[model samples]
Target chain A: MTTLHVIAHSPFGDQRLASCLRLLGADDGLLLCGDATYALKAGSEPLQMLQAANLGPRLFALAEDLQARALDGTQVIAVDYPAFVELSLHYDKVNSWL
Target chain B: MKFAIAVFSPAHAPSSRRALRFAEAVLASGHDIARLFFYQDGVHSASANIVAPQDELDVAAQWRTFITEHSLDAVVCIAAALRRGVLDDTEANRYQRPAVNLPAPWELSGLGQLHEAAQLADRLVCFGGD
Candidate 1:
């Protein structure tokens, strides 16, 4: 079954992102929120890692969080909380890395 | 849709508030909540000892009231709770502890309950972690 992996930690000091990438299925999705949104920061190693993951359209972030952090989210789909709730139903299941 | 929500952050943390809001939205949209599982530091949300400062929002109280108003099944991981000192009266008596921080509407259960809820739920949405 396809799963939506939600992460909220920093990619700089945590291993959840790397671990998630390893187990993410072909149709699975990854949603970055809170500090996890930092993964979309430009020219960062985590950005490179995410780029290599080739998540494409499946990559998403909470728009408000990105905005709060002043991080550009042009590289990924940015959704609000309402859409976040909608996405929980869009996938077969949601696995929050927390 | 049935959602099994798991909370892993402490009561004072931001994510726990987010989890509460998400659960509120889930119910507002006419969805069913399979279970509310409090693990790790999230078990503190069920504690009676949480005293929020005057300026801060009382999220723990909000969570308790929400569960009671909706008659929701709120489960706290027994292992996590015991270690974290979030004990019901039974656990308090069992452990010969004098304090009881857990109360009604919040049941202390094993981790297996989370798995069972997950099995029965359409989606398992978790909040907070290290």
Candidate 2:
């Protein structure tokens, strides 16, 4: 089995990353780090509106799906740059696990 | 499944975080990550001076941890990193910079690495916009 790490830092308004996710498949692993959560938050309004209006769950469902996968030991870690720097300093950590 | 992820976002945004989440999800699904190629603004994610606020989340650190834990092959675009002042040790010495800040677990390399990833992985997943 292969894992694809998707590093999203663009605006949620940008659907490119979402499209990539769809292409990878519905059950793929997802990690939300950095400002990507903001994008998700910002988009939540419209997504919720859509869900309430009976349009579709699209984004909401995606989030729920990703959350489920995360709880299942699929690791969806989110941290900021400083934390990343600290982790980067410890190369052994990245080399040993995934 | 073998996959490759291409990141092209600045370090402080939600898009980059989402990308990492996607990578983790991929792993959870029992897939192998071929490589992670950081390009354009994405190189800033590897910068060492990036500090997250005390209350806010630090996504870059998460990436570092993810890469380390998963043994993910992380390659930053040399041109992009250099242009953005993300200097590795060699780059720091080449430019005679006082110190090297671009941290480990991330390598400075060419776009060729991107191509290699695309060819090697079953899927080349790109995050962020053009």
For every candidate, what share of the true interface contacts is present? 0.63, 0.09
lDDT tens per residue, model 1, B16-89: 88798889989888899999999999999889999999999999999999999999999999999999899999
- Interface RMSD per candidate: 1.7, 11.9
**iRMS for model 2?**
11.9
In the range A74-95, model 2's lDDT, one tens digit per residue, is 2224434333322322221111
- Binned by DockQ into CAPRI classes (incorrect, acceptable, medium, high), candidate 1 is medium
Q: TM-scores of all models? A: 0.90, 0.61
Q: What is the lDDT of residue A89 in candidate 1?
A: 92
Query: What lDDT score belongs to each candidate, Candidate 1 first?
Result: 0.91, 0.61
For candidate 2, the per-residue lDDT at B18 reads 55
Local error of candidate 1 at residue B86 (angstroms): 0.9
Displacement of residue B103 (Cα, Å) in model 1 is 1.3
- Tens digit of per-residue lDDT, candidate 1, span A47-98: 9999999999999998878998999988999987777888899988888887
